[model samples]
Target: MTTTAVDPAKCRRCHRALTSAKSIATGYGPGCAAKIRGAAKTADLTDFKPAQIAKATELIEQGGILRTRRPNLYTAVSGDGNTTYLVARQACTCPAGIKNRACYHRAALTILAAA
Candidate 1:
C-alpha cells in the first residue's frame, strides 16, 4: 500500500507553519492567538448599542470578519457581502464609521477578538 503525504499545520490567521503541538491543535500561532485574548481583555462594549452588538455577533457567526496580516486590523464584510471594509479597534471604513458614528464592523471586531 502507498502512504499518503500529510500536510503540515499552519496558523489560521497568518497561515504560518506551526511546529508546536499546542499551536497546531489550536489552529493558531502563539502570537496570532494572543491578539484575540489580549484584545478581548481590554475591549469595552458599553458604548455600542444592543442592536449593533447583536448584528456584530451575527456577522461573526456568518464568517464576515477576517483578520488581516497586521495585528488589530480586520476586513469586515457588508450585510449583502458585496463589499469589505477595513476595521480597527478605534475605526472602520464603513459609511457610519466614516462619519464618526458607531458601526457594527468595530463591534464585530470586538466580538471576534473575544471569541
Candidate 2:
C-alpha cells in the first residue's frame, strides 16, 4: 500500500498555521474567520453609490488606506492632510458620514475588509 503525506495547513486570512482540524478544514483561524465573516456581513449591507465606488477604488489604488489595531476600524488619510476614521457599526468621523451619508472611507473600508 502506498502512504500519503498530509501537508500542514495555514489560515487563508492571516497565514498562520492551522493546527486544529476545524481551522484546517475552514482554511482560517477561529478569530480570523470570525472577523472575516463579520466584515463580509457589513460589506454586504453597505450600499455604495457610483461616485463613492469610484473614489474608493482610487484610494485603494493609491495605497491611501490604513488599518487600525481595533477590529473593523480604519483610518484613511488624504493627500490634503485630512483624516477620516471608518468605524464599523458606528458612523465615520467625516462630514458626510456625520450627516448620516455613506462616505468614500466607509466604502473603501468595506472593500478592503471584504478582501
Candidate 3:
C-alpha cells in the first residue's frame, strides 16, 4: 500500500512540529484534534445566519481576527477599518452585538476559538 507524505509544518493548535502523517494532513496533533472536535460538538450555531457564517469564514481566512489574553475575548478588524471585540458568552462591541443580536465578529471568534 502507498503511504501519505508528512509535512514540515507545525500544528495549528499547539504550534509544534507535526511528526505523524495524519497530524500533518489534518494540521493538528491527535490531542488537539480531539479537543477541536469536542469544542465543535459543543458550539452553538443556531443563532447565526448564513450570511453571518459566510462573513465570519471570510474574515478568518483573510486574517482579520485575533484572540485576546482573556479566554473569551477576541478582536476582529473589518476591511472598513472598524474594530470590534467579541466577548465569549457575553457580547460583542459591534452594532449587531449592541442590538442584542448575534454578530459576525462573535461568529468568527467562535469558529476560531473552537479550532
lDDT ranking from best candidate downward = 1, 3, 2
Candidate 1, residue 13: the lDDT equals: 62
Per-residue lDDT of model 2, residues 41-93, tens digit only: 45653477867877775665454666678876677765365655555535677
TM-score of 1: 0.63
Residue 107's lDDT in candidate 3: 77
lDDT of candidates 1 onward, in order: 0.78, 0.67, 0.70
Clashes of 3: 0
Which 10-residue span in candidate 2 carries the lowest summed lDDT? 37-46
Which pairs clash (backbone N, Cα, C closer than 3 Å) in model 3? Answer: none
Q: Could you say which candidate leads in TM-score?
A: 1
Segments in model 3 whose C-alpha atoms lie over 4 Å from true places: 1-12, 16-43
Error of 2 at 20 (Å): 35
Instruction: Candidate 1: give the clashing pairs.
Output: none
- Leading candidate by lDDT: 1
Q: Pairing residues by index, what is the TM-score of model 2?
A: 0.54
For model 1, the stretches where C-alpha displacement exceeds 4 angstroms are 1-43
